[model samples]
Target: MFISFEGIDGSGKSTQLSLLRDVLEAKGHSVITIREPGATLLSESIREILLSNKQTITSTAELLLFSSARTQLVEMIIEPALRDGKYILCDRYVDSTTAYQGYGRQLNMEHVELCNKIATRGVMPHVTFFIDVAYEQAQQRMQFTPGSAEPDRMERSGREFFERVREGYLAIAKSDPQRFVVIDGHRNREEIHADIVAYL
Candidate 1:
């Protein structure tokens, strides 16, 4: 089974993903966990470029860069793992492109969808768990104290951008109810994990 988790920066999707992976592994399943824009040399380089706050990248360029990274990841890692009968848990996937670029950046949806299709080569997760957290709450979680690590480029896209991205996620979930599972992210970690496991 291939599963992908989606959410804003501080929505706890990563934590939930780790928890789920642990449970699946304990049950003797062969599982592989990976994060998008990473997991391969080429993709890792692209990830650095994409996330660097110092680098000024255009919206179109950002979209293609993300697609480039995703293409490399899908061809080199995801496809092979699925063929090997392993459960793949991905931190983020193509839906992120749709939300971040198409909605957050206010890019053309048609182009964004086309890019996503090309990047993934039509491969999609069996199920996608979207941890839905309110934009305000998510921002609060992303807040950093003095001397702490600063936010990444994407995280600094501002309130309006993230709000649009959140709306985009909701729209995607509404359009694809069969594969998208929207979960409330305000609850405790254990409760969220139980809900995810039950869905699986």
Candidate 2:
């Protein structure tokens, strides 16, 4: 099964994902974890370009770049792993494109959808977890983290953008309830992990 976790920058999706990966591994499942715009040489290169605040990239260009990375990842890593019967656990996936590019960037959703379909070549997650956390709370967490990593291009996009992205995620989940498992991210780490495991 292909499982994906999604949310805003500081929404704890990564934390929950790590815990779930450990649990699944302990249960004797062959789990392979991957982060979007990464997990392959070419994809990592694309990730650097996407995250670099130093560069000025157009919205359409950004969308295409992300799709390029996704295409590389799916063809080189994701598809092969699935063929080998490994369970894939992804930190983010196509839904992120729809949220960040379509909603956050206010791009055309139809174009974003087309790019995503081309990127993954019809490879869809069996289940997706959308960690629900308020934008202010998430921002506070990022601000308070000790030695926090420098904010990326998207992370620095401001509160209003993230709010739109959050709404986008909720809308996507509402439209596809069967594929999406929405979890409250305000809870403790263990609690969130338990909720995800319940779905698995």
Candidate 3:
């Protein structure tokens, strides 16, 4: 089984994914967890460049970079693991590109969808859980203290951008109800985990 978790940064998708992984493992299932633009050498390098606050990358460039990293990850790790009958739990996936680049950045949907198709080579997740959180709540969660690590380039895209991204996720979920599960992120962690586990 292939499962993907999607949400804006600080929406708790990662925590839920970790929790689900633990539960699945305890049940004797082989599972592998990975994050987008990461989990592989090439992808990790791209992740650094993509997230660097100092770098000034255009929206188009960002989309291609993310796609490139995804291609490498899918080819190197995800595909093989799934073939070995392991459950793949991904922190983020193609939907992120659609939300961030397609909606947040206002890129052409056609181009974004084409890039997504090429990147994954049609390998989509069996299920995608979108943890929905309000923009204000997400911002509050993302706030950093003095001397702490600063927000990444993407994280600093401001309110309007993330609002559009959130809308994009909701739209995507609406379009694919069978594969996409929208989970309210305002609830307690245990409640959210219960819903996810119950779905599985």
Q: Which portions of model 1 miss their true places by more than 4 Å?
A: 144-148
lDDT of 2 at 173: 93
Q: Candidate 3: global Cα-lDDT? A: 0.94
Candidate 2: which stretches are off by over 4 Å? none
To one decimal, what is the Cα RMSD in angstroms of model 3 from the true structure?
1.5
lDDT, candidate 1, 98-191, per-residue tens: 9999999999999999999999999999999999999888777667433537889998898899899999999999999999999999998899
1-200 in candidate 2: lDDT tens per residue? Answer: 89999999999878888998898899898999999989999999999999998889999999999999999999998999999999899999999999999999999999999999999999999999999999988998888888998898989999899999999999999899999889999988888898888878
The 0-to-1 C-alpha lDDT of every candidate, in the order given, reads 0.93, 0.93, 0.94
Q: Which 10 consecutive positions of candidate 1 have the poorest summed lDDT? A: 140-149
lDDT of 2: 0.93
User: Which residue pairs in candidate 3 have backbone atoms (N, alpha carbon, C) closer than 3 angstroms, thus clashing?
Assistant: none
TM-score of 3: 0.97
What are the models' TM-scores? 0.97, 0.97, 0.97
Q: For model 2, what is the alpha-carbon lDDT of residue 150? A: 88
